[model samples]
Target: MTFDSLGNLYGTTYEGGGEKSEGGGTVYKLSPGSSGWTETVVDHFLPTGQYGVAPLGEVSFDPHGNLYSTTSLGALGVGTVLEISVNGQSRIFSFDRVDGAVPAAGVLVDARTKTLYGTTTGNIYNHGNVFRIAASGQETVLYDFCQQPNCTDGSAPFSGLISDEAGNLYGTTEFGGANGLGVVFEVTP
Candidate 1:
């Protein structure tokens, strides 16, 4: 989960809500209450087909208070980037093999540029990749894992990224490296 400036925690579930459950998942908020912390569902997800299933990471936010995230497997049977506001959800990009698929982690937004960055574990090479999506919804791949012989660079990043003041991205991989133990990496745009 990720915290907003106001101290509210935002996150997603892979499945289940309550006895009122529709069996997909939910976007929720946790805030400090008089007694303790309180959790409330902002919305629920559909099981499949265009709506996205199995949310995999913390919900990200823009400066305007809108929430953003991804479904590990989306309606098209790939994955999708989602932009959620009080108004509801908007599909930012549907993951297809051609564009990258099954984003396994959360997105990092550059407030200065309003751009979105994330990683996908599914691709032609089945490694992983770092991608940038602009404010207008344009996408560009910054790096694909396992590009070198024996995958000396790395593969399958399972965490979100952190960016520096210079706008470089940093993260880690679950596997692949000279010793096959994983790697910490950086990408400069």
Candidate 2:
């Protein structure tokens, strides 16, 4: 979960929305009220559709107060990055397993540029990758994991990314380092 500037807490559920027995999940907000905290369902993921479902990441806000997140499954049975604004929700990008797939984390928005960065747990090679989506919606794979011999560079990044003031990205992988026990890595843009 993450807190917005107004102190409202936002998060996503893997299941529990719509009418299906295995619901498609929901994005919700908790606002501190005079009496206590009030919960509101911001967006409900439908069990069936092309829009995507099962959000496994937290929500991020851009400079314009638009919210962003990733779904672990649905859009063509892969996943998608979504943007929610006052105008409503839109899928900004979808994973086709060529660029990347199965994003288990949310995106980090560059407040100045409105660009988005995140990691995927799987790709065509099942090694995962770190990607950058430009403000214009063009996606670029900044780094593909397991590029080195014996995958010493790491693989299967199951988390999101963090950036320093200099714009270096830091994240972790679930497996494939020197010891085959995953690794902490850094990428320069």
Q: What are the clash counts of all predictions, listed in order?
A: 1, 0
State the lDDT of candidate 2 residue by residue for 24-79, as single tens digits.
98889999999999999898888676769999998999988899989989987889
Residue pairs of candidate 1 with colliding backbone atoms: 50-75
* CA lDDT of every candidate: 0.85, 0.92
| Model 1 CA deviation exceeding 4 Å by range | 18-22
The prediction achieving the highest lDDT against the true structure is: 2
TM-score of 1: 0.94
> What is the per-residue lDDT of model 1 for residues 1-189, given as tens digits with 9 covering 90 to 100?
988998988889988764455556778999997999999998778775476877887788888988998888867777888898989888888877666778979899887778999998867788889999999998888999999988889998888899888888999988899899889999997
Give the total clashing residue pairs for model 2.
Answer: 0
* Model 2 RMSD, rounded to 1 decimal: 1.1
Using Cα atoms with residue i matched to residue i, what is each candidate's TM-score against the true structure?
Answer: 0.94, 0.96
The lDDT, on a scale of 0 to 1, for candidate 1 is 0.85
lDDT of 2 at 44: 83
